[model samples]
Target: MHSTVILIEFGAIILGLGLLGRFAGRLGLSPIPLYLLAGLAFGEGGLLPLGASEEFVAIGAEIGVILLLLMLGLEYTAADLVGNLKAQYPAGLVDMALNALPGAAMALLLGWGPVAAVVLAGVTWISSSGVIAKVLADLGRLGNRETPVILSILVMEDLAMAVYLPILTALLAGTGWVAGGLTLAVALSVAGLVLFAAVRYGRVISRFVSSDDPEKLLLVVLGLTLLVAGIAQQLQVSAAVGAFLVGIALSGEVAEGAHTLLSPLRDLFAAVFFVFFGLHTDPASIPPVLLPALALAVLTAGTKVATGYWAARRARVSARGRWRAGGALVARGEFSIVIAGLAVTAGIEPALGPLATAYVLILVIAGPLTARWTEPLARRLAERRRARTPGDPAHGRPAAEEATEPAPVPD
Candidate 1:
């Protein structure tokens, strides 16, 4: 009877998600918000809470996260990561300052303490790669000139997580300085070793993993990723980071094959992951935090746009491209939840999870809209401003043109 109930509940959840996804598709919107809403509806204090399928959803959620990072890692080679890191280090620093400071400041103002502040800072710092990737692909902006700039910032953030997660873990654990330092050392060493191996032996590793048979290839890649992710989590490193490293270690045909084969699985689990997040948060808890979350979301959205515009301008991208870049980075998703989840599990602040949930829901929904509209809106605004400006006789151009003339800035 218990098994039957679990099956029925799980099946209903999946069917509901499929319907929501289809509805979102027909309306030309992202299905993320719908999935999250569905989770809330079926979570605690909701219309129909689930008891039997919660454990299954939790496991699927973990795989969703792992696959998300792995697919992201496959998008770039180690050399590309190194190059972007070197060229875009300053932008990464700027991104951190602009986006992270606000979240930390808000936490302090709310008296959540330095620990919760740090965790909250992480919640706001990183953008949603999964959502952004989908938006870019949907809009066909992958080949846009500003895309590399946007991608560089994401790569830097992902690499930063290798250092940040371990440190956050140690701090949350209240470890002594020596113990924390040891944890940091181990994480850095593991990351460095993985990167070095990827740089030197990527092709060889791919060759070994490559299979002509699709079934065999899928099994090998999935099994290896899970094994590495598990080991990394056991070592106090992030499972996402481990999966990312495995992705980094495979290149060429193998990476392409893995991406193709695993995409459907990634999509399925990723949806479950978002729903899992909602399942944990009580719908009743969100209203209290809604005002603050809305304020923070609005503030951070502008900051993210500014961050993207500045980075893109520094790269000498055009005005429209810069706006596009900024808009693309507006969404916050899986990683924020992962960071806040750790703190929540540690019993940090009771309200932090609710706040993060509301914050992410606002941004993730707005993210796609911003990406689709920022460029067109900026262009229209620019055109109006140009029409209002008097032509300069000396330069034979309007003031707006003078202001936006692209300068050649070296990457």
Candidate 2:
């Protein structure tokens, strides 16, 4: 009875957040930003100050990211990866590097300690795939040229933990250098092989699991998801990465509607995670640090903007179109919090968790404000492009799609 009550108490907090997100979505606001705001409001930082336990909230947040990655794996195909790369192969790499490198350098310079610097670098490199994908879908731009670039970058971001997190975890566990390095290499290799094998033979293997028994298939998927996750834990890998691979493996292969099986569980707990992160952060500490947090936010936000433009310019995109793409890429959500949270877990530094949390809070607020502003900028650019090219309503079509006239012989 006591256990049930405790579960209900924690459950209600997250349930309420989802309800709030739905209401916000109805008002033309994005659910993720509102989700973060609700977290802030019901959090220690916000008015309510829930005093929620960090461990509890972390579970929810972890599941939220887990579900997101799984769903992405299901939707993504190697062809999709190839297409995404073709559109903007180097964009994500550039953005993450530019963002992470400078951040690490600054952290080192600040006398903040190596752990904090490395954590900042990792978090800065991540872009919110959940946020970006949702926003792009909402605006009906998911299939456009802009989208391929976005997707390519997002996929790279998802794979980052495979490379960085395992080593971090091993070090924190006090494993010897040789063992930690070996574990890291093994984790990457395992994940790569599994994913590569799945992609290469997905179409063939998926056929066997194609059945009408949604419940049964879902159970099978759960077994696989947890098993892979356990393997990752044994390897000192991030569970989120394991869950992602599981989801990727299960994607499109299980029964048609089987994806629905995990939705309720994902939702119920993801709320708890948001509230936990909010609770872990002490609002009183925020005042003295507000200025630096704000300054850092501005620097990162500006860098993302520049990153989008640089990618666009490399692709020979127009000045206005570049700005629109840049604008669209500005929103960052789960990646920052997840990486920061992992840093604390990895024991890379002390008081580092709180610092990372503070920085994420800043990004949460800043991301939406930038995204909101970009909406109008994109519209204006489209209008100008259309108006300037009166003869071609669709602007420019590729040579393959156009009807070519036969060339005249010598005059």
Q: Which candidate ranks first by lDDT, i.e. highest?
A: 1
TM-score on alpha carbons, each prediction:
0.94, 0.81
lDDT of 1 by residue, 1-411 (tens): 989998999889888888999999998778888888888889878899999889999999999999999999999998898899999999999999999999999999999999898999999999999889888888888777888999999988998999999999998999999999999898888888888989999998899999999999999999999998998888878889999999999998999999999999998998998898888778999999899899999999999999999999999987777888999999999899889888977889988988998999899889999998887788677667666665724233432353343432311
lDDT (10s digit) by residue, model 2, range 30-100: 55545555666766656765533445666667667676666666667655654665666578678877788
Deviation of model 2 at 4, angstroms: 4.0
TM-score of candidate 1 versus the correct structure, residues matched by position: 0.94
Q: State the local distance difference test value for candidate 1.
A: 0.89
Model 2 lDDT at residue 364:
61
Residue pairs with backbone atoms closer than 3 Å in model 2 (clashes):
57-273, 61-273
Per-residue lDDT value at 155 in model 2:
78
